[model samples]
Target: MTKALTPGSIAPPFARYSHAVEIPAGHRLVVCSGQLGIDSQGDVPPDVEGQTRLCFANIAAILAEAGMDLSDIVRINAFVTGREHLPGYMKTRDEFTGSPPPASTLMIVSGFARPEFVVEIEVIASAP
Candidate 1:
């Protein structure tokens, strides 16, 4: 199992995430591509929270393919178009992340491949 690391010498995480994670040896790793909010029917949600949920759903599917689940994730990299979308993204993200929480970074980016997309998420997972 992975260990959440938050050294006492440093400040605590600002949000619901670990500062870092220690992945043990002999574990297989999976690095997923950044996933947009579009659904199977090619529909994109207009709201950030909706989009964030879809992002996690898409990530779950990818992890499933490798015999892993959301709980196996050790790090997360997320991007939103603007600051206004931060709360919505974080709320939805908390629902998907497991106990001990994954190391995470949320950034405000100018945009993505499409203008309609408000959020994007990518993750790294490890399992023995």
Candidate 2:
């Protein structure tokens, strides 16, 4: 079983994640492919908020396929078109990762292949 990060004002709700993950030996890790904001219909959602939400949903589905959840995530990476919607991005992230939240890296890029597309996400999870 995996343990949530210990709580504290200064601590990241959990003790370890990504570069911060501190698991012992004898455990398995599951790394997920980068998830996009596209729907199962293969349609990329418009708007950063919508795309970000869809990306997390896609990530969740992948985690379930591997018998894991967002809490088991050690590291997360998010790429966006620009910084205009960053605060909103954080809000979208808060919905999936609450309390201490996860170790995340957010980047702003010039654009994506699909012009309508606004975001892409990736995650790494491990267990004992």
Q: Rate the local accuracy (lDDT) of all candidates.
A: 0.96, 0.72
Q: Could you tell me which residue pairs clash in candidate 1?
A: none
lDDT per residue, candidate 1, 13-107, as tens digits? 99999999999999999999999999999999999999999999999999999999999999999999999999999999999999899999999
Which residue pairs does candidate 2 place in steric collision?
Answer: 5-13, 5-14, 5-15, 17-20, 17-21, 18-74
Per-candidate RMSD, Å: 0.5, 4.0
Q: Each model's number of backbone clashes?
A: 0, 6
Candidate no. 2 TM-score:
0.79
Q: In candidate 1, how many Å is residue 16 off?
A: 0.6
Instruction: Give the number of the best model, judged by lDDT.
Output: 1
Stretches of model 1 off by over 4 angstroms after superposition: none
